[model samples]
Target: MNTPPNPAAGAASRIPEVATDASLVVPVIEEQAVVRREVVETGRVRLTKTVEEHPETLNFTLLHDEVQVERVPVNQFVADGATLPGVRYEGDTMIIPVVREVVVKRMLVVEELHITKHEVPTQESHQVVLRQEMVQVTREPLAPPTPGPPPAS
Candidate 1:
């Protein structure tokens, strides 16, 4: 006996859906709340310290000597190619730690000099000064406001 093949099974299947306007469709958006933080910068004064910790972490105190100039010329920025405004004992210290993989050079100063940086939130108020000037004009001073009601009667 011969068997007959099913015609519906041989055809490809399609998914079912409803027709809607493409222009009217809009993607949903999520609104989120975010908080911000306040960051403050401060100053400090310190000297170099080399820390060597085995099997843990090591630190290298990178430092430079303090040199003072007798006379400062106009606009030092133009004179020095480097942007260093000046040497000040104020600001954050840059501590670089030494690791096994990193190659570094260590130098020992002949004298351990004091290093200073402005403390964090350093004397910024000092930068501003309010000076009040009073001018005394000799003009009879308005006769004391016309003697003010007959000297309290």
Candidate 2:
């Protein structure tokens, strides 16, 4: 899927360096950078329906049997062209599947969340004890970039 970086492009775009500071080794700063995260939900048993086997007793499960689940979607019960019935369009959440545009302009979620961040500055040399942590601060999401049509050649 990825084309190799062109050798000609690499050679042509090389930065001209100033050979003033003739240091033997350049220092590299390293810190704990969280790359991948697995959001763990504790005791997350959503539905635990158990069927006990008994010969005499048969459970009558009366669901929407006549409802066309195969041909039609639950959200599209009123037909596509027909007017949408009582749809909630509040902020962040949207209903438009194809274009994926939000129906509601703004919906506010109010919650008190604790956050923590450790900023380490450059130090000549230092030592510290290792520690474990659980809770941290949540940052506000950044705005999405402007979308445009494909560039015409």
Candidate 3:
């Protein structure tokens, strides 16, 4: 088959082709995410403690101890060289023995003392001051941070 001549091929053949050794440089671009955290004060809390005193009247029962002593005469003779009796107690009364020496060189019982104790109760009133503690809580607002130089780019 017979082929026709192409016009674009003839024009490409007429242009002079130049030879060069120069290199081409291209820059690459990248994108990244940045994250940061900072501490900030919003408000403040305050605690207050106080003590209060109040006068009060108190009532109580008081106990008092009273002692009574009585002496009784007893004429009794004991054997010679007998030992003296010691003090003894009967219920709430305490008995003490008294002895004497006769002219016949014998021991004689003279008198005895009986002592008793009693407790008496009475009502009494007294004035007293009592202390109490009180607590109060309050919230305070904090001022914002002062303006400063802008961050570097």
Per-residue accuracy of model 3 over 71-140 as CA lDDT, tens digit each: 9998888765667777999999999989888898787889889999999999999999999999999999
**How far in Å is the alpha carbon of 136 misplaced in model 1?**
37
Against the reference, the lDDT scores of all candidates come to: 0.35, 0.40, 0.88
Clashing pairs in 3: none
User: What's each prediction's TM-score?
Assistant: 0.12, 0.13, 0.64
lDDT by residue (100-126, candidate 2, tens digit) is 113553222222122222333433433
The per-prediction CA RMSD against the true structure, in angstroms, equals 41.0, 43.1, 10.7
Off by over 4 Å in 2: 1-23, 39-41, 45-153
Q: lDDT per residue, candidate 1, 39-81, as tens digits?
A: 5334333444444433433344444454332332232112223
Q: Considering every candidate listed, which one attains the maximal lDDT?
A: 3
Q: What is the lDDT of residue 138 in candidate 1?
A: 38
When 2 and 3 are scored with TM-score, the better candidate is: 3
C-alpha displacement of 128 in model 1, angstroms?
A: 34
